[model samples]
Target chain A: MPNQDEIFTWVHTAVEAGANVAFALSGLLAGIRKQLDVVGICVVMGLAAFGGGTLRDVLLDRRPFFWVDHPGWLWVLIGTAVAAIYLLRTTHYEFTERAIQWPDALGLGLFTASGTQLALAAGTPALPAVLMGVISATFGGILRDVVCNEIPTALRDRRPYAVCAFVGGWVYVFAVRFEVPPATGFLLAAGSATGLRAAAL
Target chain B: MPNQDEIFTWVHTAVEAGANVAFALSGLLAGIRKQLDVVGICVVMGLAAFGGGTLRDVLLDRRPFFWVDHPGWLWVLIGTAVAAIYLLRTTHYEFTERAIQWPDALGLGLFTASGTQLALAAGTPALPAVLMGVISATFGGILRDVVCNEIPTALRDRRPYAVCAFVGGWVYVFAVRFEVPPATGFLLAAGSATGLRAAAL
Candidate 1:
């Protein structure tokens, strides 16, 4: 159970790793659905990967957003999407599904925690922070669905996706307020989110 | 030149009509691309139509956003997209393009004016208001581009799109500051935008 600074650093590292994996898998899914080309794959992956954080920063009026600060962030998605698309062409759907779930779950958890933290830092109240957390966790997928011309899976389906984010976010908030060690709280929230999602599946 | 109130009325009318057309077009494009079912078409259309305004409101932190206040706005896009998609398979692209461009131009002009006006209302400085106007005019297309996995057309090729918006926005700002009638300023701004886009093409 590390303190706040260490927990924040850990969260950042996890999110970056998770984002790359999510970007790759999302591209593979888009290609499998035949709604994307090589260029489209990379584009969707990048957009889906970065859209949430960009929205968070814009709303907070934080200049030089994550993708802007780290130019490599954008390219990571580009490279991952390209590679994923190529590999997906010959891979089995079952294997792809099996491989993608964990990273996606990681991204969902890390984003939920980080988004809540951002909102709190920006002086948003608890309810709004929770909403922002869910938005940060799920907005990328919604954007992807809209662009792909599908009903957003989050809105249409009764999945545990956003619900897990909401619960995890509240857990993080309560833990922080109680002065619990941040790392322990973050891990607990993420672990619970992953468990819920896996159970839902 | 029309009075301020009259100009505002016209601009509002144009937005209403253009919103319908934009929504319709999103469905038509999605259908042509064969990426969606009818429900998906409706979702895409609604998002395309309201997406810009929603983004603007979120960035501006204006509570009870336009769409939230008027749920009818959502229905309007839904109906329009449905009708357009149903009629689209039998239509010719060239003819459709010609008819749609007029409303789109009107929408662009009005959106630019409204965006500038809103920014000014929010007490943003003149230059920022002008920039906001341009963003309002072009953001829908950017949203469309992102969803379709293309570089934002505005940022891609130099098309005089944002330039037209900036000039028109300044026209509105100057008129308002000179105590010219609001409607007169609006028409001048909208007309300037419409003509510039036409001429550019």
Candidate 2:
């Protein structure tokens, strides 16, 4: 049987990967709406997928960026973007846009939890670490929309997007502070954020 | 008498300080245009002034941050913002906006050159180093506008802003490659970018 640490690592990686895919899908949809070329779409996808994590790493002074550490994820992103472009061509924009919300909420939870955990591990103070989680969970979409010349939905949308991340980050921090079991604490944090976002939607 | 390296450090610090003020001033103008409150104005000012260098430092894994290293500069920024707010309230909007161009252009040059030089110092490759210069020169203003919900002037302006930075970065790179004296090379790069941007304006 795998150790708790091993299981946490696997689950963490998978969740982040799924979250990345959700963000990349949103980028693809944005690119398609903007009528961007293939290169533009890829660029947007990369920014949308990695911007938050990159910002978090920078804030924490971490090395080997998330995308750099997982080079295969780049290929995965490209494949997802290409496949998505084809699949969504016939889909209604309204439905496609709404469909992205589910995974985006998942992304909100997992990214917030992971980003907070990373910050705590790095020995950052609580409030700033929680801010890091929010930044990690939201900055990618902000970058995408800003690049596309639209107001960032994270900032402008009425729904409680960043609030979910904020709550999730605090949950993780409190869990760690209280010595909750690591994996369970992580899951609880993520679940709260995802559930909150889903409820808001 | 100070050594050559000592002179370089002094000159670099002064130029960067001046550039930071210029960016903060632009941020003030932006905040006033958007009618932000006092705290909002200060937040925008900080983001506009430090966003680029912070981004570059993060990319290069360099620390302590420029503002952090010079804690006095934070006071300077607040003072400048407050004083400018009082001074500009009586001035014509058109005049204040145009007056900002001179310093903004100067910032573009110095920031581009310094960012590239820093990248080179970090052992980054040539092309990537030049790109870093462009990012350093441009990204702050981009963040400022994005936060303000306006399209980034860096992206939309027909003027030759980033192009000047690109050229300036190459000038610095080539100067270093060919064994030019450091101070002269730095000035040459800055002058080229400033002149180019001024001409475009």
How well does model 2 score by local distance difference test?
A: 0.84
Return the TM-scores of chain A for each candidate in numbered order: 0.85, 0.92
The deviation in Å at residue B118 for candidate 1 is 3.7
Residue-wise lDDT of candidate 1 within A81-187, one digit each (tens)? 66666666677534455667778887888888788877777776665576567777777777666667764665445557877887888887898889888677777
Clashing pairs in 2: none
Q: What share of the true interface contacts does each candidate keep?
A: 0.05, 0.13
Compose the digit string of candidate 1's lDDT tens values, residues B63-170: 554554555655666566666656666675334445566666666677778778888889988998888887777776676555555566679777677788888899
Q: Pick the candidate with the highest lDDT.
A: 2
Give model 2's DockQ, 2 decimals: 0.12
lDDT of each candidate versus the true structure: 0.69, 0.84
Q: How many Å off is the CA of A138 in candidate 2?
A: 1.2
Number of the top TM-score candidate: 2
